[model samples]
Target: MSTSNGMRPETPETPDHESWWSRIGTLGQALTALTGLIVTVVPILVATGLPGQDSGNSNFSPTVVPTTSQPYTSPPSTTPPPQAEGINLTVSDQLTDGAEEEVIVITLEGSRVATLHATREQPVVSQRVTATRAGNYSYVVDAVMRWYDETGTEQVTNATGRGSVSIDDGTRLDVYVHEETDGISLSLESATQ
Candidate 1:
């Protein structure tokens, strides 16, 4: 392609097929853009749903579909029942007219066994205690008495008693608290096996 100056004339490349080729090139570019949009927007649309609607389930969400089901049964407990003998200890109050209220605390072998509240009308309380072994158990009783003085002021007195009793199987023991001439005294009244 030489001209008068011995150089090629300036002209468009592929001049004969430019019109059809450019349209096809444009269509290829459009297809590439549409493919890129699908690749980007389809995942986004699937991850987060449409603008106002709820997002669909996540791919990582776990769904459980049971194939076979049976009624659940609980396991049995392993603890055993107590097998030692016990004693039914009884407390009776013998306060005549000097006290309005009394609180008796009984402790067996340094551990609190029971606390008995005795009033004027009801002056008896009992509790059954289980012994791991058959022997004489030492007990301590602490008593508090409350009454009114002549001037309408309240009066208080405290007394304590210590004793030991033999407890056998199916034994019932009775202890009594009496208002003595000095103060109060706790004594084992009787025991029945």
Candidate 2:
């Protein structure tokens, strides 16, 4: 009269598949604490607003725009063309008129001319002349007295005379003349533009 169902008495429970895995681990810890309280009250309700106040606001007003500019032009000027005139001559000393031949003639002003000759057995003579004209001009210097007076016929006049002129654009002018002892002196050192 005894028990023989594997010696009976042996019942420690918690089974039914551990109460269905303990109700699925308490429903995954209540859905991870409701997703961490909705990720910490949704940024504190978008940074304070519900009973935490100050939701940002400073009468906002800032906007300005306007700009335009364009206008200015000036440049054009040129001038040139005005110059042409020049004359030069020189003769200093030795143009005697004692016993014969002597002639010094220099005339310029578009008609340009130059001649010089001295003789009393060759006294002295020098000459240099040039000019074409471009504005104002007048020149004349004569010293003639070519003689043979004992009636062999032949005698010239202008024993001594002087004159001058200038105002050129063809460069410059330089004049010099000297033959004293009964006259003939003229000078106008230099002139240019």
| Model 2 C-alpha lDDT per residue in residues 55-112, reported as the tens digit of each score | 6756556654444564443446667787654444343336444437766665654354
lDDT scores in order: 0.71, 0.57
Model 1 per-residue lDDT tens digits across residues 22-48:
767978878988999999998998777
In candidate 1, position 9 carries an lDDT of 92
RMSD of 2: 35.2
**Worst 10-residue lDDT window, candidate 1:** 87-96
* lDDT score, candidate 1, position 162: 85
Residue 184 accuracy (lDDT) in model 2: 53
